[model samples]
Every structure is written in structure tokens, then in C-alpha cells.
Target chain A: MTKMTMVEALNLAMRQEMEKDDRVIILGEDVGVDGGVFRVTDSLISTFGEQRVVDTPLAESGIIGTSIGMAVYGLRPVCEIQFSGFSYYIFHQLEAHAARLRHRSQGRFHVPLVVRTPCGGGVRALEHHSESREAYYAHTPGVKMVIPSGPRNARALLVSAIRDPDPVVFFEPKALYRAFREEVPEEEESMPLGQPQLVREGDDVTIISYGAMMVPVLEAADSLKEKDGIVAEIIDLLTISPLDDTLIASSVQKTGRAVVVHEAPRSFGPGAELVARLVEKSFYYLEAPVKRVTGYDIVYPLFAREKAYMPDTGKIVQAVKETLEV
Target chain B: MPRSEIELPYRIEYLSILDENGNLDKELEPDIPDDILVKLHREMLSGRRFDERMLNLQRQGRIGTFPPIKGQEASQLGAVATLKNSDWMVPAFREALAEFWRGKPRENFILFYGGYDEGGAVEEGRNDLPVAIPVGSQMLHAVGIGMGIQYRRKDDVVMTFFGDGATSEGDFHEALNFAGVFQAPVIFICQNNQWAISVPRSRQTHAKTLAQKALAHGLPGIQVDGNDVLAVYAAAREAVERARTGKGPTLIECFTYRMSLHTTADDPKKYRSEDEVKEWEKRDPIPRFQAYLTQKGLLTDEVVEQLEADIAQEIQGAIDRAEKLMAREVDPLDMFNHTFAELPPSLILQRQEAELDLSLRKEEDRHD
Candidate 1:
């Protein structure tokens, strides 16, 4: 096992997949010789050549539209949107064509494509670069949304996404890209999408979250255990769209209380869907109602107030306490 | 000093072989085999019959909606005739005739028009894209496919069909620009059928010709008399040859007219005058080609009659087959299945909810 960052894990997955399948190609703005804006695709251009790892002109719609054609023509394309906010420009191609091609084609054509973009706030980046809009994609049918919390999960989930027979939107939490490192297996291994991983086990209230928010949730769990003698179960719902309700239900059943957390706005966010599912499936097992600790429903604030805008250990611990009290 | 008024440089080439009276210009006649000529005429006539039958089917509410190619048969037949089975074709909405030439099943179009499914069947390796209705969107697909072929080291060329109105779209320019930079093997065939819905050709662009628009993209541009079957065929053949030999993409603009409404639902009378339609009718390609064939002693009156009967029967058989086909029940889970290769947990729950909703509806219906 070799220790790597989330970015390195992603790069390795892409390299391995491209080597395994000639049909697999990558396209995005600044993905070629420049690597990626965050260096996630560093050294890819030299390894695969420019034809396989393409640096397309800065047109989001053009990138996605062309990928559709390539996919239809028997090529597997993995496109990178420089930032999650920029991905909005190609929603017509993503929602209208990429998502519906198979069902509309009556299973005649399958779009084996992956669109990877860095999402979430707390990176102190410019406006439009920091936004968690996984809910928007999850709401739209015909796209699978995957958000990996750590290096090992990122490598496994991305490989699975690349080989999947349908279009996938892989959201890499920007804040976690270099914040943490872990030993990832050198050999190729894949984890099935739509399945949640139990990061830490405990008998007390469960701390359910994903993406960058996983860091704060884990820290909050530690705080609760060390200070208050509360052993919190931390569950990372890696794949957001096809949520692992079975895993969530089982955890909530054991703990008897749940606190969903995320960096996206509180109202109608990804966490809302999680809470709704928990309520419906594990309602009888719950000792208290599911509570969400999330960002406020407003535009991501300036750097001055960035700390307050994002979920933190304090907010998550408070939520856990509130849920436990009720 | 007064502001300088700079002149924009432009070059346009016109290719033709048929005169206005439907007589073959002796100097430019193609020495085609008799069997090939017969096949061309047969396909053109069949396309016309199919267009008419589809229009009737739409009116009878047997099919959904249709984009008819009533007057553009020769333009479509001529351009598509030059394509080998290995070459690729990307079509805009109005290229139903071209779709037929590309071997797209008539039943697929019928099912698409009937709103039963998204017209999906393009025989693998036949290199045909499904009908793109978003105006000029298919141009990009054509360029991308050409790029893919180039990467694979294949000698295949791609022919993309669009319209006069598509020239105004940014995608058209982007596609052309990419093709130029990559020196991709592609032939951009623009069927200038005059009107885009209610908008006229003049409104689409201020340029003297759509073909000349290709100059900015660093490619040769040629215009041909679309109603003259031989002229359209010759121009397309030249362009295809150029692309196949690695000379890069060419833009061939076929000057044609739209003889019918945009589709079965459109009212052309709201936009154009009867006199304009009458003027274009004088140059109708079907009768013109028929006259030329008769003059050459290649097509007897008996042969024409038999050809018409044969095409009519073939169309009727297609209609019967489409009608007899069983409609598949809509699967709600299908909506979730293709979105990702693996089902996400949230989607699985949503699918369960949808199934529960369907069961509830069935239970209510039983009570009613």
C-alpha cells in the first residue's frame, strides 16, 4: 500500500483505467500539459499523450457535447469541469442528452462517461468555484453522483465510475483534496457505487455525512467521545444520488438517533434527502427525529465570513447533542 | 480621417451538371453506369413517396409529428449517394431523406414520430447518428466523430447535414473551427431550404451565400443547384474524395427550396406567399430528373409506372409493420437504470417510492 492524497488517488485511477481501455479518454480545460488547476491530473499528459488526455478550449457546453458524440461512437470519455460552478453551463447536454440517451434510445446506446468536478466550500477560492450542488444533479434523473471522502474511497469509486455503463457525475470535495492522506492499495480495486461506508463504529448517536463535511463530522465525533463520553457512529455516504439507505437505516437502528451534516445549504439540500429517507425507512427504530447541521441557505459568503458559512465541529457536536436530548 | 470601411475577402465555387430545363449539360455529364442511374432515381422517388405517406400518417394521428423533406429529395439523394457504407453521417431534423439513405429503419422514424421512443437504432458501424433536432447541434458531433476516426487511423470520412438557419448558431462556427485546426476528414453539407420555421434565409444571415461562410474556417466552400440531381451528386462526390484522401473537411451548400411546411404542425402560409411556392415549383427536381431520364431513353413510361407502384407498396408495408408493432409498457425503474452503471442509494429509494406510487394508483383504479 502506498500513501497518497485524494488528488493522487484520482490520478492513479484515471491512469489505470486509460491503460486498461483504449476507448477511455479524458477532456477538460487545462487538463493536458498544465495538469489540472489543482494538479489532480498532473503527469497524465506525458503518460497518455495529448490525444488521450485532451486539453479542450474553455467551452463547457462544447466539452460535454463533443464527449457525447465520442461516447456514442464507442469511446469512453471522462470529462473534467474546472470547477463545479462552471458545470452549470453544460446542463442541457448533461441533463437532456447524457442522462436520457439510454432510456430514450430504448437501451440501444449507453453513455459510459464520467464528468469529474471539484465541489464544496471552505477552500477560500473565488466565487462560483465553491458550491455544493450535488442536490441539483441528484434531483435530475439519469445521472449518478459520487462524492468520495478520502483517498482510498476516491480511487475505488472513480475506477467504478469510469467502467460503469452510464453517465456519472463524480464530485471531488475540493477542501479534502490535499488536507488528508492515506495509504491506497497499489493494485486496482473498486468499490460499488451507491453503497455507504461505515468509517467509525459506535453505539451512541450516528454522525451521517459526506464529502468535505466528513472531516468536521469525524472531529466532532472525537470531541463528543473524549469530552462527553458519547461514542458517535460516523458514516460517510460516499455516493450521494443513489444513497445507501440500507446502511443508514441499519446504523440509525443501532444508534437510535441521527445527525445528518453537509456543507450545502440546509434547505432542500443533499442532507434533506438523507434525513427524509432515514425518517421513512428507520422511523420506528429512531429514539429522536433526524437533525441536519448544514450551511445556511445563502450565497457562499466572502472569505471574511467563510468560517461561519461552512459546517464545523462545534455545529455538528451541538446538533448531535440536540438530537440526543430530544 | 473618416473610419475606414474594410472589405471582407470571400471565395465561393459553384458546381453543376444539369441545366435549368432538366437537360444534362453535355460538357459536365458523368459517365455513370445505367444500373447506378436507375438506383438513384428509384431511391429519390421512394423518398418522395415516403415523405407523402408520412405526412398523411401524421394527419391521421397514426404517428406523432414529422419533419417532412417533400421537395429536397434530389439534394438529399445526391449528397448521400456519394457516401460509402463505412463513412459516417450526422443529420439535423430535416434530413429524413438522408436518414433513409444511411440505412436507418423507417420503423425507427415512425416510432420516434409516434412519440413511442427516441429514434435510437443506428446500425452499429453503419456510422449514422440519430436525428438531432436542436438545430445546428449535430455539427459538433460530426467534427468529433471525424477527430475520433483520425485518431483511430481510419480512412473513414464523415458527412454532416445541416440547414441555412444553422449557420447563425455558434456550434456551427465552433465545429468548422475545430475541423480546420484538426484537418479532420468531414464534409459539411448545408441544405439551404430557405426558411427556418417562420424565419427566411435573409433573416438567417446577411452573407451572399452560406457556402462562403466556410472561408472563415479555412476550408473550401462550394455551392450547387440542389434541384439538379447530377450537380448535387458531383459536388458531394468531390468533397467526399477530398476528405477521404486527408485533405480535411469541405462545406458544400446545396441551394434548395422547402416545398412543404416545416413539419406536419407548421403553417407555412403564415410566413410566405403562394407566388414564391409557385416559382420554386417550376424547378421541382422529380419531374426535371424524370424528363432527363426519358430524353436519354433510359426510363420508359412503363418503367416509371412500375417504379411508382413498387415504391407505394414498399411504403404501405412499412406503415403496416409500424402499426402492428406492440407498444412496450413504460418502466419507471428504467429512468434510474441508465443514469449510472450502478444504482445510487438515493435513486434506489426514489425508485421504490415511484413503484409504491404506481401500486397505489392501481389500487385506486380497482376501487373505481
Candidate 2:
């Protein structure tokens, strides 16, 4: 066991998978000599050789489109889009081809591909570099979308994504890449996708959040327990698509109150869907209306307004307290 | 303006094996067997007949909207007819003729357009891709497959077909560049059929020729007379051989024309002139090949009659096989099947909800 950042965990997951499966390959800009823009694929080329770790041209459309082809041709190509903000250029290939291959082929073929990209804003990168657009991929029915809040789970879910028989969009929260470290075991742990993890247990109110937002939600949980004696149940909604309604509903049903938190815009974001599922399944059990603390519905703005737009611990605690009061 | 740069790039040669009057150029002609030429003619004629019948199928409300493959058969069939059994074929929407030549049953197209789930499956055991609708996307996939072959050190080559308008897409250059840099075993064949849904070739790009676009990516590019089947076959065969030998990719620009509307729903008269249509009619692929076969004494009146009857019989059999698939009879739930290898829990829940909704609708219909 060793302490590893999300970046190291990601590299380890791919390295392990590639070591196990000869078909696994990494293709992306600067993935070879530079080890990717965020070093998520550090030293992969030297370890696996250039044949397995390919540094591609600065073309998102080609990276995704060709990866789809490779996936169809029986290669498990884990493509790095570098940034989720730039993934829009390959949306046509993703939605029209990669996502639909299985259904279109009537089970004859599948796109066993993993698209990993840095997602959301906190580090305040330049234009078209930071975005929380997991909603877009999650909305795409065939693409299983997974975002990691911490290092260990990131490695586990990535291993699951690589071996899965369909396309997966893996978003590693850029803010959480190097935020902290945890003991990630060398042995691969395969966490089935579409399942949320109950990070903390409580009976008062369930705080549902995932990815970087888990940080502030946990902080709010700590503060609420200390000052107000409000033991908030915290659930990390790891898999954005195919959400774990069973886990979410059971937690909210027990608590009888819910607060959804995310850094994405409040409108139609994953928080909206989580709240909807809660209302549908845990409606009768709910004691108070479910609340959401999220970013404002606006393009991720510059650094000054960035933090203002994102929900913080104070805002989350305020929402949780409001729900608890009702 | 910035100071002039060095010489831009090398311009490759254009190849034409048959004259406009269907006279073969002895020096440039490829030595294909006589029986293969006859088979080529029969397939080309059947493809034209199929195109004509498909239009009738759409108008008769038997099938949905379609893209006609008229005037582009030489570029499509000639290229596909050269494929080895292990080679892969990546095609676009206007590739039914090529698909047909490569063993895709007519019902495959019929069921695909009729909206059946199984229609998109490439014929069992075949390496051909499904009909991709997104323009210019398959080019990149072909490069990837080629790269995979190179990595595995396989002798098999990848063949991808696109159109003139696709050259303007960014993926076109990216695919070509990657194919060049990686020395991937891939053959790129573009059916530069004069019009992309009424946008003339002149409007698509300022470059003198679409073949020249490959030069910037450091690949060989050749322009061939697309209506001359012999020329198209020679160019495709050469390119396929080059790729198989690990010489990397080659781009073949088949200079042809789209004689019909882009699709059954389109009206080419809205953008193109009658004079241009009449001029391209002289270069129609079927007639040009028929003329050469006639001059070779291989196409007599009796032989022509027998060929037409055989193709007509084959087409009737295909139609009979396709008549079983009905648009309104398909199950709505079939949409969720094969979405994943095993239905994930979320989709299982969604599918259950959809079933419940359908039952409710049926109950309401019973009341009505």
C-alpha cells in the first residue's frame, strides 16, 4: 500500500490494466514524452513502450474517432481527451458512434473504450480548460459516466471502466488530482460502476455529492457535527450515469431529509436528477423538502467570480440546516 | 503580409486508365482477368438496378428515405471489389453499392432503413463497418484500425470510403497525418462525386484538387477517373497493396459525379443546372463499362439480356427477403437491448418504467 494522488492512481490503474491486458493502449496529446498535461500518464510510454502508450496529434476529434475504431477492432484504447472542456469537438464521435455501437450492432460489437479527462473548475485554468460537463455525458444513455472524488475509488472505478464491455467517460476532478493522498493498494480493486458510495453514516439528513464537491460537503458535515450536533449522512454519488438510486433512496429514506450538492450548475445538473430520484422513491418518507447547493447556472467564469459561483461549506451547512429545521 | 515560405508541397499525379469514349489505354490498363471484368460489369449493372429499385421502394412507401448511389458505382464497387477477405471496409451513408459488392445482403439496407435493431450489424463474420451517417468520422476510425494492425504487425489493411465534402472536415487531415506518422496500414478512398448535396466541388475547398489535400499530411495522393471502373480498381488495388506492405496510407480521389438527388427527400434542381446533369450523364459508370465490354466482344446482346434477367431475379429474391420487416410492427422495447453487454441496474430500472408506460397506453387504447 502507498499514498497516491488521483493522478498517480489513474496512472496506476491504467498501468495495471495494460499490464494485464495486452490490448490496452493509451493515446493522447503529450501522453508519451510529457506524460500528459496533468502527468496522469507519467512514464507510461517508457514502461509499456511507444506501441502501447501513443502520443497523438492535438486533435480531439481524431483521438476520439480513432479510439472508437480501435475499440471496435478489439483494442481497449483508453483515450485521454486532456480536458473535458475540449471534449465538445468529439461529441459527434462519442454520441453518434461510440455510445451507439452496441445497440446499433445488436450485440455483435461493442466499443470497449475509456475516455479520461480532467473535469470541473477550482484550479482556475484558462478558457476551454475547466468545465463540469459530466451531465452532458451522463445524459448520453449509452456512455457510462464516472467521476472520482478521491484516489482509491478513482483507481478502482478506472479498473472497472477499462474492463467493462462498453464505452466509459471517466472524469478525474482536476481540483482533486493532487488535493490529498490516501493508501491505494497495489492489487487492482474493481468497483462496479453506477454505484454510489456512502462515505459517512448519519441519521439526521443525507448530503449527496460527488467529485470535488465532496470536499466541501464533508467539511460542512464536520462543522455541523461540532457546532450544531447535526450528524449529516454524506453519500458520494460516484457514478453520474446509471445513478445508484437504491443507495441514494435508502439513505434519504432513513434520514427523511436530503441535501444535494455539486459544483455544476443547479439547473438540470446531476443534483437535479438526484433530487428527482429522491422525490420519487423517498417522497413518502421525507420529512422536509430536498434542497440543492450548487454552482450558479453560468459559464464557469474567471478566478475572482469562480469561488463565488461554487457552493462552499457555509452554503451547504445552511441548506442542510434549513432542511433539518423543516 | 508575412514573407513567402518555402515550396508548399509536392503535387501527386492523376491517373486515367480509360478514355471518355470507353477506350482502354494499353500502357496504363491493369491486367485483371477477363472473368473478373465480366463479374465487375454484372455487379455494376446490378448495383444500378438496385439503386433504381431502392428509389421505387422509398416512393412506394415500402422503405424510408434513402441516399441513391447512382453515378458513383465505379468509385465504390471498383474499390470494394479489390478487397481481400481479411481487409476491413469502413463506409459512409452512400456506400450501399460498395456494401452490396462486399457481400452485404439487400435486406441489411432494407432493415436498416426500416428501423430494425439488427439491421446495423455488419453481415455475420464480415469486417465491414455499419453505415456511418456522421460525415468524415469514419476516416479517423480507419486510421485507428490500421494503427492496430501495424501494432500487431498484421498483413491485413484497412479501407475507408468518404466523399469530397469530408475533406474539409478536420478529422480528414488528422487521420491522414496520423496514418502517415504511424505508418499505419490503411487505404483512404474518397468518392469525389462533384456535388455534396448541391454544394459544388468548387465551393468545398480552394485547393486545386481534393487529392492534393493528402500531400500536406505527407501521404501519396492520386486522382483517378471515377467513372472508369478500370482506373478506379487499379488505383484502389495499388493503394491497398502499398498499405499491406507497411508503406503507410494512400489517398485516392475518384473523380466522379452524383447523378441523383442527395437523398430521396432532396431536389438537386434547387441548386444544380440541367446542363451540368446532362454533361455528367455521358460519364455514367454503368454505360462506360458496358461500352468497353461491348468493344471487347464480351458483351453481346444475348449476354446482356441474360445478365439483366439474372440480376432482376436476384433483386426480386432480395426484396422478398426484405418484405418481412415492417416499420409499425417493430417492438419499442427493442431500443434498450444491446445498449450494454449486460443491462446496468439504472437502465434495467428505466426499461421497466418504459414497459409500465407502454402497458398503461395499451390499457387506455383498450378503453378507447
Candidate 3:
């Protein structure tokens, strides 16, 4: 085991996969010589050379669209969009071709492609760099949407995403890129996509979150235990789209209260889907209405108001307290 | 120092073999075998017949809306003829004739138009992508396939078809640029069929020729008489050879006409003049190709009559088979089947709900 940041872990995952399988190819803007903007793919071009570690032209749609073709043509292409904001250019390709290819072909062709993009707000970045729009990909049916919280699981989930037979939109929370380190295994390790990891086990309240939001959720859980004498169960939702309803429903059923935390906006977001599922599955066991601690409905503010926009440990603790009271 | 002008020495070539009046430029005619030449003519005629039948079916409210491939048979068939069975054909929506020639079952097209997901299913081992409906999307797929071929060290090239309007799309430029950079073995055949629904080719772009757009992407480009089968076939063959020899991609612009409505649902009278349509009618691909075949003693009046009769029968048989297959009630469960290789727990539950809902409906129907 080695203690590494999320970026290193992700790099190790790609390196391991590419070393193991010649079919795996990495392509994106500056993914080659410059490694990546975040250096997640640092020094990969030297190891795999330019063919496997490709530096593509600055076209997001072309990157993903070509990846789709390569996937269909029997090459496992992991394409990187510079940022999640730039991903909008590839949305039509993702939605129209990537998502529909398997369904449209009716099992004749399947796209086993992975699109990795950095998301979430923190560290005072540019306008489009910080927003979490995972709901866009999660809403897409054929495509799998996964967001890893930390280094250890990021490595594991990325391996799984690469191996997944269908298209996977793997969102790496930029905020967590170097925020912390975890002891990732040297040998191969993978966590299944649809299963949420129960990070903390408690009886009072369940806190469900993913990606960078897990930081605040964990903080809130600790502070709640120390200050308010309330125990909280933490579920890091690795995969957003599949939304491990079994885990969420069972946890919510046990606690009878829940707070769903995410950095995405409140309106028509993944939180709504989680709340709806909680209502449908564990309504009889509920002691309180499920509260969502998420970004506001308005646009993700610039740096001046960015901290205010994101859900913090304080807000999360408060939401948990409110849910407990109800 | 005085500034000197820098000139890029490049000229886009144009190709024409068979003329409008059933005349062939003898020197430029392709050296195709007699048997393959007969097969090409048959496929072209079959495509025309299929289009006519599909139009009739649409008028009778039997099939859903689809684009008609009229007046562009040579552009579709001729280019496809150059491709080997191992080579990939990534196509935009208007390549039904090409798809048919590439061993895709005729029933698939009928079933697709008849609104069945089963329609999209190509048989195993066919190197053809399902028709991409969005304009210019399949070009990237072709390049990617070419990249994969290069990666695998395979000799198979890819042939992708799009329209003149597709040249304006960012994907087209990106695909071309990538193809050039990677030196991917891809043949990009642009079927410049003179119209994109209500808009004509003039409004689509200001470039003198769509073929010239390839110059910006660092690839060879040529304009061919799209209605001339011999010209399209010759150009595609050259492009295919260039790609197969690892010389990278080439862009072949087949300049043709969309001699029918853009789709069965469209009204050409609103956008185009009758004079333009009549002028193109004189250059119909089928007759010109037939004339060339007749000159070679490969086709006579009796042979033409018999071929038409046989094609009519074949088309009718295909329609009958498709109608019979679709007559059976499709399982609603099939809708949730293909989205993933293994159904997730969430989808599994949804599938159960759907099953229960369907059963309840059956019960309600029984009570009624």
C-alpha cells in the first residue's frame, strides 16, 4: 500500500490498466507531454508513448466521439475533458451517440468508453471550472455516471470504470485532487459501481454524499458526534446514476432520518431523485422529511460568494440537526 | 526587409467519367470486372425500387418518416463498392443503399421504418455501424475506427458518408484534422446531394467546393460527378487504395442531387424550383450506368426488364418478411433489456414494476 493523492491514485489506475491491457488508450488535451492540467496522468506518455497516451486536438466532442468509435472498434479509450464545464461541447455526442449507440444498435454495438472530467468548486477557480453538473450524465440512461470521493476509492472505481462494458462518465472532484492522501493498494483493487460505501456507521441520522461533498459530510459527522452527542451514518455514493437505493433505503429505514448532501444545485438535481426514492422505499420508517443540503438553485457564484454557495460542515450539521428535530 | 507573399501550392481536382447524356469518358472509365459491374447495376436498381416502395408505404401510413435516397444511388453504391467486407462503413442516416450493399438485411430497414428496435440489429461480423441520424456525427467514428486499425496494425480502412451540409459541422473538421494528424486510414465520402431539407448547398457554405474544405485539414480532396457511377467508384477506389497503403485519409466529394423530397414528410415545392429538378432528371444515375452496361453488352432490354421484375419480387418478399416479423407482439421487457449488459438492481426493480403493470392491464382487459 502507498499513501497517495487522488491525482496519483488515478494516474496509477490508468498506468496499471494500460500496462495490463494494450487495448487501453488515453487521449485528451495535454494528457500526453504535460501529463494533465492537474497532473493526474503525469509521466504517462514516457511510459506508454504517444500512441497509447495521445494528445488530442482541443475538441471535446471529437475526443469523446472518436473514443466512442474506438470503443466500438475494440480499443478501450479513456478520454479526458479539460474540465466538466468544457464537457457541454461533448454533451450532444454523449447524449445522441454514446448513450444511444448500444440501444440504437439493439445490442449489435456497445461503447465501452470512459470520459473523465474534473468537477466541483473549491480553490478559487475560473467560472466553468468549479460547478458539479453530474446530474446531466447521471440522467442519461445508457451511460454510467461515477464520482469518487478520495484517493483509495478513486483508484479502485477508475479501474472498474475502465473495465465496465458500457460508457462511463467518471467525474473526478478537482477539490479533492490534492486535498488529502489515502493508502491505495499496490495490487489491483476495484469497488463495484452501484454499491455505496458505508464510511461511518451510527444510529441517529444518515448523511448521504459523494465526491468533494464527502469532506463536509465527514466533518459534520465528527462534529455532530463530539458537540451534539448525535451519531451519524455516512454513505459515500461512488456511483451517482445507479443510486444504490438498497443501501440508501436500508440506512434511511434504520435511522428514520436522512440528509442528502451534494455540491450540485438544488432544483431538479440528484438530491430530488434521492429524496423521491427515500419517500418511495422507506416512507413508513421515516421520522422526518429528508432534507437536502445542496448548492442553491442560482448559478454557482464567483469566488467572492463561492464558499457561501457550497455546502459546508456547518450547514450539514445544521441539516442533520433539523432532520433529527423533525 | 520587404514582405514577400507565401503561396500554398494546392489545387482541388474534379472527376467526371459517365456524362449526363449516357456518355462515358472512355479514358477515365474504371477497370471493373464484368460480373461486379452487373452486380453494381442490380444493387443500384434495387435501391431505387426499394426507395419507391418505401415512399408508397409512407404515403399509405405504413412506415414512419425516413429520408429518400433518390437521385443519389451512384454516390451511395459506387463508393460502397470499393470497400472490402473487412473494412468498416460508418454511415450517416442517408446511406440505406450503401448499408444494403454492405450485407445489412433489407428487413432491418423496413423494420426500422416500421418502428422496431430490432431494426437496428446488424448481423454478427458485418463491419457497419448503425445509421447515425444526427448530421456529421459518423465521420468521427470512421476516424476512430481508422485509429483503432492503425493501433491494431490492421490493413482494414474505413469509409464514412455524410452530406455537403455536414462539412459546416465542427465534428467534420475535427474528424478530418484528427485523420490527418493520426494519418488514420479513413476515406471520407461526402455525398453533396445539393440540398439539406429546405436549404440549398449555396447557403450551407461559402466554399467554392465542399471538397476544398479538406485542404484546411491537410488531406487530399476531390470533386466527382456523383451521378456518374464510374466516377464515384474510381475516386473511392483511389481513396481506399491510398488509405490501405498507409498514406492516410482522403476526402472524396460526390456532387449529386437529392432528386426527391428531403424526406417523405418534406415538400420540395416550397423550397426548390421545378426547373432545377428537371435539369437533374436528365442526369439520373441509373440510366447512365445502364447505358454504360449496355455498351459493354452486359445489359439488354430483356435483361433490364427481367432485372426489374426480379428486384420488385425481392423487395416485396423483404417487405412481407418484415411485416410478418413485426406482426408478432413485441415484449415490453425488451425495452429495458439492451441498455446495459447486466440489468442493475434499480432497472431490475423497474422491470418488475413494468411486468406487474402489464399484468394488471391484461387483467383489466379481461374484466372489460
TM-score for each model:
0.55, 0.57, 0.58
lDDT of 2 by residue, B1-368 (tens): 88986775456788888867777799998988899899899888998898898899878877666789898888888888888878889997898888887788888777666534456677677888887665677889998988888788889998899998778668788899999899888889999988766456775677889898888888889999999999999989999888888788899999999988777766666557899999999878887788888888889889999989999999888887777654335565655666568877766665564455455556646976
lDDT by residue (A1-326, candidate 1, tens digit) is 99999999999999999999999999986676557767788888899998998876545777788999899889999999878987886788999999999999999998889999999877654446678888889888889999999999999999999999988999999898999899999999999999988999999898889998988898898889998999998889899887768888899999999999988876799888888888788889999988877765555643324564566677687778888898
Q: Candidate 3's residue-wise lDDT over A1-326, tens digit each?
A: 89999999999999999999999999986677667767888899999998999876545777898999999999999999878987887999899998899889999999999999999988554346678999999999898999999999999999999999999999999999999999999999998988888999999999999999999899889989998999999998899987779988899999999999998977688999999999998999999889888775554544434554567777787789988887
Task: Report the alpha-carbon TM-score of model 2 versus the true structure.
Answer: 0.57
Docking class of 2: incorrect
Clashing pairs in 3: none
Chain A TM-score for candidate 1 is: 0.98
For model 1 chain A, give the 10-residue run with minimal summed lDDT: A299-308
Clashing pairs in 2: none
C-alpha lDDT values of all predictions: 0.83, 0.83, 0.87
Off by over 4 Å in 2: A1-326, B1-10
lDDT of 1 at A123: 60
Interface root-mean-square deviation (Å) of every model: 18.8, 18.3, 18.9
Compute the DockQ of candidate 1: 0.02
Two-way TM-score contest, 2 vs 3, winner: 3
- If ranked by TM-score, best first, what sequence of candidates would result? 3, 2, 1
